[model samples]
Target: LQELPVFAALDLGTNNCRLLVAVPTRHGQFRVIDAFSRIVRLGEGLTASGRLGQAAMDRAVEALKICGDKLRARNIRKARLIATEACRTAANGVEFLDRVEREAGLKLEIIDRQTEARLAVSGCGSLVERDTQGVVLFDIGGGSSEIALIDLTGHRSPRLANHIVSWTSLPVGVVSLAERFGGRTVTREIFAAMVEDVAVRLHAFDGRDRLSHVLASPKFHLLGTSGTVTTLAGVHLDLERYDRRRVDGLWMDRDSVDRMVEKLVGWDFQQRVANPCIGADRADLVLAGCAILEAIRAVWPSERLRVADRGLREGILSELMADDGAWRSRGRQ
Candidate 1:
């Protein structure tokens, strides 16, 4: 607790390896000191091959090395690193993990699906309304989508009391979807097919009949935390530049989202690549995300969607601070 020790969080996923460093401030707030993200495409070819390619592994290791250096430079006192789906599904995941620990000097924990969804919820929990009835929270990553339905009245936490009523992880993600359907340029047919695929998987979640009852009520909110949602938000804002501060914590109605998706789909690959907020890096995969978002809209039919740029990393940091009593003390100050 002395001098507000800095905490570091590293998230290594199928598509990106990222690191974040932060110092908790008074009033239970924290300020980000540093962050690093590299799209390594670690899960490339995993869907068909059922393995993380050697080339992908090498890319991830290099990224982790850079993250290690950042953590060392900052001399982080408390740090936690985690690896997701691609690591857990790959045959050589353990081997790659060993290499990271020995070569990069970092131990990476492979968490289960439930933990992934829970952490995502924790990261965005601060945005949930305590009295807002049934709200759906989801994170669409490269390898999977984590969904959690919570009843607002169930919240017990000091800041928010939302309780998770039903949660599920869909196996579809941008990478997988792109690999399955197509990522480069999506046709209306391909787009509709992709959304249909996602809708089928969503059937496993808590009884839709029960969820619908809650959704029918007023102030029901849908919270989305992922590159997909954030990208859509950026497009909606029509920013010549992407600004997380402006996109995150913002609200977009169903009509706006639908219109934006239509505009994005109609744009040629070159036009999408030219957009400042999307750029070339995400141009190919944007359609895959649009498909997923459209599917969620069909299922839940919400009027508004809460966009969150925060997720796993924020969730992990919050959990660490809460366990260490740092978050609680910060509030008292």
Candidate 2:
């Protein structure tokens, strides 16, 4: 295991399948050696069907096969493969995973909402400024959205997730929301309806008052780790092509977010597909994401939001490296 230091984390979510392989670095971080992401729409029609359809299962299995091949090719010391909201909620989720194990030679563990929230916080830990008093971090996923209210009042823990005071996992996400509303032909009215629906769901969360209290302080800001926010950041920058270095950890003010959402709402399906950052694959779904973000913005109304392109996969790698004492052993060596 010591000789082969690579670790892998695979997150098979409702809409995407992603894999990351990394080696531990200084200060409890890791350097990415390889990564893969594919929008397979594994949860398509899942909302209406209640079970994973055969086609969706097939698409997911094909993606997993590629991931399995990569894992086998590497001399990996440890790895954690996880499935999120889709697998957690789908009636045929277990059976589908078993099929994945058989066809793709991968076993995917379905993680719960709380763990999802914590992983997101862990993934974006470095992005949060040390001086910041509090943060409202959110992950808008394909099948669900996880929001965490972090309070760093007394003392900061090595694990940023330790600072999370309250968290909520909304049942609605990009895929589900788009399915609820219409995605491809989104009008201003349709966009408003989407936001209102998510707002209704957000009303049930108990952390609203707590977050509202934290918002009064200037040090508190919103941080988002998801494709939805990342895509918005990309569109806002007017990048010729999507660049992670510039997009990740970038700051967008309330007005900027509002402006971007408005611009997107104005765009037709063809216009969205023409966008370099949001290509044909994401064209239909981006507005649904914006609506989710809008609901979040309405609740907290932060002046600035820090964008995060990192999430569950990064979190998994960090935890695996820490748990294995890879950094401690390296220091000794």
Candidate 3:
């Protein structure tokens, strides 16, 4: 295993920076050997300023430096680094990235929204069942949310995203939503406003009804990949601490999700921070994320929602390995 080729994937989202280093497996998949994640709040003031703040950029650069050091420590065979919504909309995004390369020795590409949506689907592919008729997969990010309506009514392809019937990336996310509506003290009315804002944007997507037939099928469900859903899953389990092993691929029925959201809505800021699953780092932003999730649920009512902790980074690794034909020798001695 030590001698196997290593691949790296890094995602610098609006709220966090994450890295994944893995080695291809005999079955065409990859096993993570090393990983890193940090909430740098790269888009902390993006909505009001329309530019990344100096303090935010510094935090992100520091995180990227750590990632750069990790990448250099290994015999990396390939790597793909990317920045999402924050960077795409930021006026000084390119400039800030320049500083990153000069200071951290890492170059990141700002991917388009469709690409973001597709990669999210790819990352969460394993969560979908083989017999599933359809899915409305959504990734809620710090700066924007990407939704993919996958119609798997026919024979499924190896890449789940290939079956995408319609996709949309809304210019709304936890950071922006929180900053706008005041996350720390969300009243029912404030929460409702946030939901309506996102719902307006989501409902406008002409493809919102694209998967009506699939939704009518018994196998159809919602697949969510983001910190929001993962947090809800952790709370629902009454976990003493965050555990990816337990939360990832977890299924929460509609009623369970409703109860969890209601539970959070009733708590004060400190109460939210007290919960192990919603620590101080995420307390303020959790409600905003919930608002986004609620809007999605309203548009696409599903009996169940599958939570995925994996997203862009895993998607990048999957695509890179496939492109390099790492799986061609599967099962070979």
Candidate 4:
């Protein structure tokens, strides 16, 4: 292949369905050319009912239809679609995937927790610090949070290659959080309560002295790949609208994150909905996401947190393209 063939990856999460189209470049990198995401809240009622709601499924299918159109338009050579927590927990998940494959002309893979953690690390590896002795990566999503502890000294210890020594999937997300606590108008007390709730949950996965371990290392880094961090980046930049270039790979300190949360919490739902960055789609859920971030920060008090706008979709694209060795070789040559 003279030119790298186009590839696609779709991620259907509990709250959002997203698609990305990209082609590998000569520099051993893949650049996304087009992407789409829709908030269908696929896991809207999964928390209470333990099953995906029909309305939610319909909303997801509609988003998939749009994704199908985009994939067809891009003439993608290979594509992979994966559904996360929502599908994994849904009793009718297999039935939904079957319908997606037949109706959307796309096959869906429901990945397990371990695979989810690995893929997230792969997709956001660029954000990892090279000189760090150890790093903790946490992804806060709509239905689950995946935490990975990466040992940067892995090359020194063969056993450390699988350095994700500590990994956990928290059974909470923005949708569930928002639904549990009123997302309409949050006061400072309510926000603190929400953070405390998440913190209590984190007690189950607390790493003994991970903060101290990172504090002792000069190269310690924090990588967060989730809507929460990305949205914070967007708000921090004070963007009139969402811009990935300005949001991705951005850095924010603890104080900055706290300020943003305060600003959003102070805003009524209507005011938040009016903000271009928060918009109608994310206004309600953004506060809940902020609470999750606060909880993570409380546990790991990193001065600087790196944001990763990329996640599972990029991981899938990388995997499919990697499987095609000839295609990768062609890119290298």
Using TM-score, give the best candidate's number. 3
> What's the TM for model 4?
0.90
lDDT of 2 by residue, 210-301 (tens): 75556878899999999999999999999999999999999998899989999999999999999999999899899999999999989888
Q: Identify the candidate with maximal lDDT.
A: 3
lDDT of 4 by residue, 1-333 (tens): 366588998999998899989988653358789999888999987878888889998898889988988887866788888889989988999999898878887788999987888778767755664566777788888988887777666463322225666676777888888888867778888888889988988888755354465555657667889988888788889898889888888988768877887888888889888987888888888899889888877777777788999898877776777677524476454
Error of 4 at 293 (Å): 0.7
Off by over 4 Å in 3: 26-28
Residue 63, model 2: lDDT of 89
lDDT of 3: 0.94
- Model 2 clash number: 0
Judging by TM-score, tell me the better candidate of 1 and 4. 1
**Candidate with more favorable, higher lDDT: 2 or 4:** 2
lDDT of 1 by residue, 198-233 (tens): 988887666444566678776797899988899989
Candidate order by decreasing lDDT: 3, 2, 1, 4
Task: Estimate the TM-score of every prediction.
Answer: 0.95, 0.97, 0.98, 0.90
Candidate 3: clashing pairs of residues: none
Note the Cα lDDT for every prediction shown.
0.84, 0.91, 0.94, 0.80
When summed lDDT is taken over every stretch of 10 residues in candidate 2, the lowest stretch is 207-216
**TM-score for model 1?**
0.95
CA-only RMSD, every prediction: 1.8, 1.6, 1.2, 2.7
Which structure is stronger by TM-score: 2 or 4? 2
